[model samples]
Target: MTQSRPPLNAPHSTAQSAPGALPGTPLRSPADVLGTGVAFPIGVNPRGQLSMVSGERAVTQAILSLLMTARGQRVMRPEYGCRIHELVFAPGDATTLGLASYYVDEALRAWEPRIEVEQVQAQLDGQDTSRIVVDIRYRLKGNPEPRSLVFPFYRSL
Candidate 1:
C-alpha cells in the first residue's frame, strides 16, 4: 500500500509533523495562510452550497467591501466601514480629493491587515467633473508583487 500526497491546497489533519519537514511543525495549506472568505455578491455553488473566495481574491473582496460600505450601514458594526461616502456632497476640488484619499488610506489601514497600503491617489476624471477617481496600490505583506484598485467616488454636485 502507498499513501498519496495531498494537493497543495488541501488541509492536513495529523497530530505529527510532515515527514522530513520539521519535527514539531504542522503542515498547513498555503491558501489557508493567505486567507479565505465568503464571496462578495455571494452566490450558490453548483450543488447549492455558498461560494467562497480565497487568497488574493478574498483580500480584494474585503477591501472592496470596506470601500463601498458607508459608516453605520451595518446594524451592530457601525465603525466597520469607510467615510468616503460622506464626500458625495462635498465639492470635487483638490481639498476634496485629498480628503477622499485620506479616508481610503485610513479605512484600509484600520480594517485590513493582510496587505500593506503603498500609495493612494484621488484624481479628477477626464470626462466627469463630478467624479473623483481613487487609485489604490497595495501588496500582501510578504509578497513583493503589487496590485492596484480604482474606485470612482461621485459627488452630487
Candidate 2:
C-alpha cells in the first residue's frame, strides 16, 4: 500500500501568524491606518490617483461640502446636512434673508467642527434679482485667523 501526503501549498496546522500577514510585522494604529491628513475627492485630478489637501483650502472645501449637502441625503444620518437649497425658492426679502442666515449658521454649527462661525449674510444681487450671494465668515479651530467664502445661490423668478 502507498502512503498519502498533504499538498505542498496547503496551510500548516501549526502556523502562528494571521492569514496573509507577514511574520514579525507590527500592526498599525487606528490613527495611522486612517491617516491624519485629508484626502482629496476621487477623480479630482486627471491622473485618477488620490490627492491630499490641507490648511485653508481644505477647510474651505469642507465647508462647501457641508453646505451643499441637503438634510436626509446621507445614509443613517438623516439630519446631518444643510437645507440651504430650500431657501432658493423662498421669497427674497429682509426677513427671508435673516432666516436663511440663521439656517446656515445652525447647519454649520451642527455639521462642521473645524471652524467657529463668525457671520453668515445673504444679499440679493443688485443687477440680478434672481441671484443671492451668501457670504460666510469663520475662524478655523485653534487658529485666530478668519476666512471668508462667498457663494452664489440662484433661483428662478
Candidate 3:
C-alpha cells in the first residue's frame, strides 16, 4: 500500500508519537532501523557519491516534509561550503510535492552545491519491494565535471 508520510506540521508531532517518532520521524521499517543506523552513511563518500548514509529515512522524509511545508523559499547559499544548506530540507505538509521538486531545482545549492540537473532517469529495482532509484545527471557550474547521483526510496509496508 502507498502510505503517505506524516505531516511535518501536525497537531501530533512525530516526535511525540512513538519511538522513532519521539526521537525522530518515522522513515523506515523497524527491522531496518538498526542496519540503517549502523550501516548507512549519510554524507559524501570517498567516491564523491551523495550517500544517504544514516538517517536516510528521516532525511528523505524531512525533505518531503520541507517541500510540503515551505513555500517557494529555497535554501540558497551564494557562499560555497555553507553548512546552512543542511537546513534546506525540513518537514512540512504531507500533500505538497513542492519540496521534492525543490530538491531537484536546488540540487546545486546543496552543501557544496555545484551541479545542475540536465536529465533525470527514475527506475525501480528489487521487484518485491516498493523501492525507487532516481539517477540524475548534472553539470557542475564552474567546471566540466559531470556528476550523477542515485537516491533510493523505500516506502513503508
Candidate 4:
C-alpha cells in the first residue's frame, strides 16, 4: 500500500480546528495542556514522594517560578527569566511599580504558553514601603474564568 503526502505548496492542515472550536485554539487534553510537575520549593509529600502539582496549580507554580528566577542566573539559559530583578534596587515609586508591571507582562508573554495575561499591576505594599506587590491577572487559554496571583517582591531580597 502507498501512502500519500500533501503537496509542499498545500496550506497547513494544522490551521484547521476541531468542530465547534474557537479560532487560534487547538484541542488538547487537560493533562497535555495544563501540565504536571514537581511541586515548587521541592518538598516531599506524606507518602515520602516528591510533591507534585497539576492543572491550574501547576500552571500557577510555573508562573511563580518564572517570576522568581533572575535572568542570567541559569548559566545555560541566560534569558530564561523575568527582568523584574532589575528593579530590585530601584526606588519603590510609581515609576518603579510601572516598570515592574511591564516586566511581569513581558516575561509571561514571552515564556509561558498556558495562559493569556490580562493585566500585570504592581503596587507598593501597604505596610512595607520596600515591598512591591505584583498582581498578575490571567486566564488559561480555552478557559474563560479569570485568575490572579499576588507575588510580593521585597527590595531586601
Best by lDDT: 4
Score every model by TM-score.
Answer: 0.81, 0.68, 0.32, 0.79
Top candidate by TM-score = 1
TM-score of candidate 2 against the unseen true structure: 0.68
lDDT of each: 0.88, 0.73, 0.42, 0.89
lDDT of each residue in 34-138, candidate 1, tens digit only:
788889998998989899989888999999999999988999999989999999888878999999999999999999998899999999899998888999999
On the 0 to 100 scale, the lDDT of residue 45 in model 3 is: 60
> Which portions of model 2 miss their true places by more than 4 Å?
1-41, 44-47
Instruction: Output candidate 1 Cα RMSD.
Output: 6.5
Q: Using alpha carbons, what is the TM-score of model 3?
A: 0.32
Candidate 4, residues 1-157, lDDT tens digits: the string is: 9999978666564666557766535666677779999999899999999999988889999999999999998999999899989987899788899899999999999999999999999999999998999999999998999999999988766
Cα RMSDs, all models:
6.5, 10.8, 22.1, 6.3
**Model 3 lDDT per residue over 19-41, tens place:** 43445545454335422322233
Query: How do these models rank on lDDT, best leading?
Result: 4, 1, 2, 3
What stretches of model 1 exceed 4 Å from their correct place?
1-30
The runs of at least 3 residues in candidate 3 whose Cα sits more than 4 Å from the true structure, single-residue gaps closed, are 1-113
